[model samples]
Target: MVTLDWTATEIALSLGISPVGCAEISGYKTWVNVANEGLADAVDVGRRQQPSLEAIRKLQPDLILTSRYRHASIARALGEIAPVHLIDDQENEDDMLASVYQSAHQAGAALSRSDDVARLLESFDGEIEKLRTGHAGQVEGRKLVVAQPLPGVPRLRAFAPNAAISGLLRKIGFADGSQMSAQPFGFATVDLEGLASLENDSTLFILGEAIPDDLLHASLWPMLPIVAQGNVRLTGIPSWPFGSTASLKHLARQIVTRFV
Candidate 1:
C-alpha cells in the first residue's frame, strides 16, 4: 500500500484511488471534506509541512508519494525509507500537466489501477476544450482583482503569470492589477480608501485558505462595496485559489458558463 502526502492524496482522490494511509494537512480537515470522510480509516501521517516520520514508518507503505511544492526536501528524506516521488510544480501548464498525468499513472501503478488515470484525463479533455472555445471572445481584455485573505497577515497574494489562478485568469482574458502582481494585500484592511488608488473598472476575485468570520459576521460585509457589487469571486480550491490542473479545468468551465 502507498502512503500519500496531501498533494498526492488530493490527486489520488481525484483519480479515484484511495491510499492505505495519508498525511493530514491543514487544508484537508477543512477543505477536502469528502476525501477526509471517505478515508477516515486511513492513518494520518501528520501535517503536510511536518509529517511524522515515526508514524509514517509504522504504516510500512510500499511507496511514499508526497508533493514537491512545500516538501521537496522532505520527499528526499522519505526516499530513504521507501521509493519517493518528489514532483516539481515549478513548471508551466504543460509541465504541470505532465506531472499530473505521470503522478496519476504512478499512483495507479502503486495501487495497480493504471487505467483509471487515463480514463479520468480523457473524460476531462472535452470539457476543458469547450470552456476555452466558449470563453474565447467573451472575457477578452477584462480587468480582475485577485485578492488573498489572511486574518493577521499584512499581505495578500494576487494572480501571477505562472500561478495556477493566473493561468485560468489569462485564459479568461482577465488582467490583474499591476500592484496585485507586485504585492499582495488584505481585503479587510484595503477598503475603498485603498481601492480608490486603483482603476475603477477592476473586477474583484477573492482567494484564500479561509477568510475570517469577522468579514461576514461584522459590519464589514456591507462596508466592502466591491464584494457588495457582486464582483467578488471565491475560489473553492485552497492552494493558489485554483491550485491543481483538475481545478484549473473547473475554473475554465465556470468562466465560460458564468463569468463570460
Candidate 2:
C-alpha cells in the first residue's frame, strides 16, 4: 500500500502497517513525527500536492491512500495506477476528534486492519479517560488558547473550538478560549491585537517552536493579562495538531506532563 496523506501514514503505522511508499517523507518526519519507524523502509513518492506518479507506479502498490482535500484533482490519475482510497480530511467539521477516529476506521477498512484499529481506539479512550479523571481537579474548566507562532512573523495561528487539538483539550476538561470561530481548516491567523479579546485568566498554550525573540520582546507582549500573570506555556515539543489518534495521545501526555 502507498499513502499520500500524512494522517493516513500515521493511521497505517498505528495499525502496524508500513506503507510501501509515502509522499513528503521528510516533511512528515519534521511535522507529523509519530510512528516514524514505520516509514523507515518506505520510498518517497514526492510532495503531497504533486506526488511523483512515476515513482508511485514503480512501487506497484495494490492500494493508494490519499486525502480528498489534497488529492481530489488527481484521484482519477491515481486510480489509473491502482485502487485509490480517498480519506476525507474534513469528515466531521463540528468534532475534529471524531473525524480522526473516522479517518482511522476508514484506513483500517481499506487495509483490512479493522480489528487493530478498534483496539487502538479502545486504548486511546481508556488513556484519555485516565487523564481526564486524574487531572480534572487541577485543570478542568480552565480556559486555554492554543496557538502556534508563525516562523519569522509576529502573527499566530490560533486553534478554534472545532480544531482537533481544541477538541482533545475539551475532552480533558479545558475550555477553548480562542476568539476565532469554527473554521474549516481548524485555525485562524491573527495579529497580536486580535488576542486582546481573550479572558485575562486564560492560559496560552503555544505549540511548535519557541516564540521568536522579536515577538517575545515586542512592546505589546507583556501588556497582555495572560503574559503578565505568567499563564503562557511553550509546549517545547514538536506537535502536529491535526494528526491522528496516536498523535493526539502523544500531545495529551505532553500537555499533562509539561503544564499540569
Best by lDDT: 2
Candidate 2 C-alpha RMSD relative to the actual structure: 1.3
Off by over 4 Å in 1: 2-4, 33-38, 91-119, 135-138, 153-155, 177-198, 208-230, 235-242, 251-260
Error of 1 at 231 (Å): 3.7
Clashes in each model (backbone N, CA, C under 3 Å)? Answer: 2, 0
* Candidate 1 lDDT by residue in tens digits, 121-221: 67666666566566767666767666666565433444444445554566555665435332221122454445444455666655543454645555545
- Per-prediction TM-score, please? 0.69, 0.96
Worst 10 residues of 1 by lDDT: 180-189
RMSD in Å for all candidates: 5.1, 1.3
Clashing pairs in 2: none
* Candidate 2: worst-modelled 10 consecutive residues by lDDT: 251-260
lDDT of 2: 0.85
> Candidate 1, overall lDDT?
0.57
